[model samples]
Target chain A: MNAIEVKDVSVYYGNLCAIRDVNLNVKEKEFLGIIGPNGAGKSTLLKVILGLIKPVSGEVRIFGKDLKETNKILGYIPQTSGFDRNFPINVLDVVLMGRLKNRLSLFHRYAKEDMEIVTDLLDKLGLSDVRDRQIGQLSGGQLQRVLIARALAIEPKIILLDEPTASIDANSRSQIYSLLKELNEEMTIVVVTHDLAAVSAYFDSIACLNKELHYHGDKELDEETVEKIYGCPVELIAHGVPHRVFKVHEEGYDD
Target chain B: MIEAFLQYVFLQRAVYSAVLASIVCGIIGTIIIEKKLVMMSGGIAHTSFGGIGMGFFLKIEPIIGALIFSVLTAIGITTVRRRTNTNSDTLIGIFWAMGMALGILFIAFTPGYPPDISSYLFGDILTVTELDLKIMIALTGLVIFVIVALFNYWKAYLFDEEFSSVIGIKTIFLEYFLFVLIALAIVALIRVVGIILVIALLTIPPAIAKLFTFDLKKMILYAIFLGIVFSFLGLWISYQFNIASGASIILLAGLTYIAAVIIKRS
Candidate 1:
């Protein structure tokens, strides 16, 4: 069964339309990369899938249930740049927030098992040494990993990330993508980003979106398809990443 | 002053009530600062004045009236903040002025030998009665029970409201529940530190605690201890100089906040 299905969806902000008549089907364990330019409704589409924003039309089903009913099956990692990193919280405390189901009562203690799970995630993510450290004290890469640990703590069947590597350095970006690749083995993963090179190399399937679902399912990003999706003859953004670089012939020409 | 407590029932009541007020301030204050709702809290604190006026007009206990008015205004502000696209500052400002105006109007309309609410306005901690002490303690106990019982929810809600809502936390209701707690805490503090000065006690201790620790639970415990120390120090200072205890206490808290800021900066 498909992990997520979006049918005939559209969204608006006041008078401005964002996504229109968007339809998609994401099979389980698929690493789906959604690529679009800024203001192309990439993030908005992710929000729609996560039930954070309701599409003005159409239906969203996750694992054969309504999105709202199946929301618990999805974990989300929003952009790291969107928060105040100086907030007074330790890594363990932040991750524990994802364990909402285990919170039996106000007076109920976090069980030994819960702590064990947190420690295990911390260790697996190579963050065990800094579990007690303040969030503000961490590097961009470390902070991204902490947010991933929090998202994974819920054991969701699918994880959605919106611009996870937007502000990080090059090393952190590759590490984050590699981590996403590894996590794709355990759960379906959907990422919304503008990094075409990483999308070509790591994502199992690519969805080229620009206000509408231009290409809902494919991994073969030929030069023509890339040019069509971006509405321009794209520049080579490979930056030494293992991607099929675009060969420029004449001006605005694709070989 | 310590000797005075031994002989005067009112002084003893005032001291006990001050402690109770501090407990509520410390506990709820931590959540307030963490949630970044200090300004919203100020609005509610000032809005309680309308209730105080109502109490005087109806010949009822002022604290009881303050509690009702403050909780309603909290709910009202939450509505306006959510449903309307109006700026938050504008909404708060309107309620703040409306509350004070209604309070003054009610006081003016009260029959001859009107209720003496000068202490409630400027805060005279020494005027606390046994009834006020009982009310403050009971309110503090309730606030502790709610906050502790829903500690997990508070953590989740405070950290990220959108994420909390997505995680099946009934975030909207929790938001209202928290606002009501803020309202209750404000009313409990009205006698110890007048409405004008209550926000200081609600915010200063937690702000100081944040300087030392990043953990919410630790911040609360630290703030509670600071609240007690500052209250007593202010009480002692007022006794020595024959000044206003409420103003003295708020003044001490404010000064300590400045000190903490300077120390951290250096």
Candidate 2:
């Protein structure tokens, strides 16, 4: 059974059509990458899938249940840019938010099982040392990892990420990708990204999105498909994996 | 000094009401400051003036009027801020000025404008009655109960509204619940600190408390403690100097905030 099914979904913000006629399906344990430009509605699609925003038309079903009805099953790691670093909250408290649904009482202490899971997850992410630190004091990479740990706290069946590596250093970026690769083996993962070079090696399948679904398939694409989706021609590069580089065809193009 | 403390029932009532109001302000104020709604609190306080004016004009209880008007204004502000892309601050400012204007005009039109209007303007803490003390205690209990009962939901609500809604916690309901709570707190505090100085009580203690702690829960507790201390000290100073209790309390809170900022910088 498909883990997520988006059937001809359309979303709008006032008069602007953020995304339209979008259709996609994800199988269990598949790693899917969504690639698009700045205004390409990639984040909007992720938000709709996660039930953060309502679609203007069409339906989204997760594991044969409607999107609204299955909120508890879906875990989301939002883009790090949206959060205020100055927010005064501890890492443990933020992670504890994931367990809010299962809490029976206000005074319900964190059980041994809950602590065990949190400790194991933090240890795996190499963030056990900073468990007591305020979320505001962490580096961007550390904060991103903490957000991932929060999402993982739910032990969700599917994890949806939006630009998980946009602001981190190169070494941390690779570490995050490796962590995501490990997570993808356990659950279905959908990531929306603009960093094509960084994420290309990790994604099993690519969904090139604009206002609509330009392409969605498993086989690695040639230069032509990448150029078509990006609105430019692919140039040859020597060192990187057979990647696509768009040439400056327009007058105002930079670099 | 000891004789002065117990000389009058009014003075004793003032002490009780001040302590209760300070605790409520400290806890709820931390949430307000964290949420960056200081101006919203100010707006609520000013709009409550209109309610107080209506009560005086109609010979009804001003607290009831303040509760109704402040809650309605809170709901209006919340809805307008969410639904329309209009500048919420502009709407708040407009209502703030309008409410004050309506209040002054209504009081002037009333048959017998009591000289106690000055007491509501700049709070007469020395004149606090037993009824005022009862209201303050009841409101404090209600605030504590609501915070405890909705502790889990409030954690989500305080973190991120969209994220909380994604987790099925009903963002709209939480927003209304918060506004209602704020309105009730503002109304209860109207008599102790008055409308002009209520925002200071609602924001300063919490802002000062944030400098010392990273934990939200601990920050709230510390803020409450500091609020009570400042309120008592401010009341004593006001009594000794024959100054306005409302202004004195706000000045004390401001001084505490400044001290916290300096210590943090050092």
Candidate 3:
């Protein structure tokens, strides 16, 4: 069964088209990486899947159901920049937010069992010691781990991350990627990232997107796809513009 | 001061209500600062002036009018914010001015001479009647009840609206509920600090407490303690010097905030 299916989807930010005619289908537990440059609708595609933004055309389905209907089975880790750094929220409270999906959430308190689950997930993520610490006190890597632990607290079947390691250090990026690689063993993983190297190394299926899907399949990034996505024929443009400008000035001076 | 509480009914009411307002301030203030909604609260407080004027013109208690007007403007701001591209600062500034203008117009049209409306702008905490105390107690209870009932959701919503909503939280409902609660908290503080100083009372204690602790519950506790102390000291100072009660309270809170900054730096 496919974990996520996007059919003929297009999105626009009012008048400007962001993503156009994109199609994707991920088999259950498939590791998918989407790569694109800035302003390339990479994050927009993920937001469409997360139901944060409705596509201007077409549909997104999760676990063969509408995205909203199957939301409880999905987990999300937004970029750490989404949070208020000054909130006095402790790690445990932040993690426990994942349990909000429980049916009998008595007075919005985390049940003892829910706490146990959070503790176990934190331990697995190597964040057990900082469970009581304030979330703001965490390093980039640690905060990302806490966010991942919170996502796991939902016991989701699929997890979506947007630039999970964007602001973190290189060592932390490796740690987070490895952790994600391990989690991919059981759950469907979809990540939107700008790191082309990570896509080449880790993703079973890589989709190169620049307003539209330039390449999609179980293949590493190729030179052509990279050029198509970035649209930077830099050497050709550099040779043309500077040479032409210099020639024009040289002739004018000689005259 | 202790004997004064036992000596006068008005004093007893002021003390009781001040404690309640401080607790509400502590709780709501922490959320406000963390959410970066301090300016929004100021917008709401200033707009409540329209409600006060409406009450006088309508021959009703000014607070009732303030409550209705403030909640509506708050909801209006939230709605316009959600739908339009207008910067929130501009939206809030418009409402802040409109509210004051409306208040002034209504007061000008009120028949015969009226009570000084500056009482709403610069509060007289010593004038808190027994009835005002009862209403404040009820409002405090309401604030506590809502916060306790929605603690986890509030945390999730405040932390990340996107993450919380994707997990099936009703974030829109929570935001509106919070706005209403903020309005009620503002109303409670009106009598204690008046509209002008209510934002200070709602913010300073939490700011001071946040510097000391990162735990939300602990922050609230420290804020409540600080708020109560500031209110008491302000009340004492005002009684001794016969100055404006609200100004004195806010001034004390302001001084403490400076001390906290100095302490942290040193």
Interface RMSD of 1: 2.5
Give chain B TM-scores in order: 0.96, 0.95, 0.98
* Among all candidates shown, the one with the greatest DockQ: 3
Q: Interface RMSDs of all predictions?
A: 2.5, 2.8, 2.2
- Choose 1 or 2, whichever is better by DockQ: 1
Model 1 lDDT per residue over B241-262, tens place: 9898889999999999999999
Which 10 consecutive residues of model 2 chain B have the lowest summed lDDT?
B112-121
Query: How well docked is model 2, in DockQ terms?
Result: 0.45
lDDT tens readout by residue for model 2, A72-184: 77788988777666677878777767766633355446677878888888898888889889988999899999989888988899998899988899899899999999988
Q: Write the residue-wise lDDT of candidate 3 on A1-255 in tens digits.
A: 899999999998778999999999988998988877788998899989988888889999998998766757888998888778667888888888888863425386567999899889988999988988888788999999999999999999999998998999989988998999999999999999876556656778888789998887864444445556778742332233223211122222220
Off by over 4 Å in 1: A102-104, A222-255, B113-115
Clashing pairs in 1: A106-B149
Winner on lDDT (1 vs 2)? 1
List the per-model TM-score of the A chain: 0.90, 0.88, 0.88
Badly placed stretches (over 4 Å) of model 2 are A102-109, A232-255
Which window of 10 residues has the lowest lDDT sum in candidate 3 chain A?
A246-255
CAPRI class of candidate 2: acceptable
**TM per model?**
0.94, 0.93, 0.93
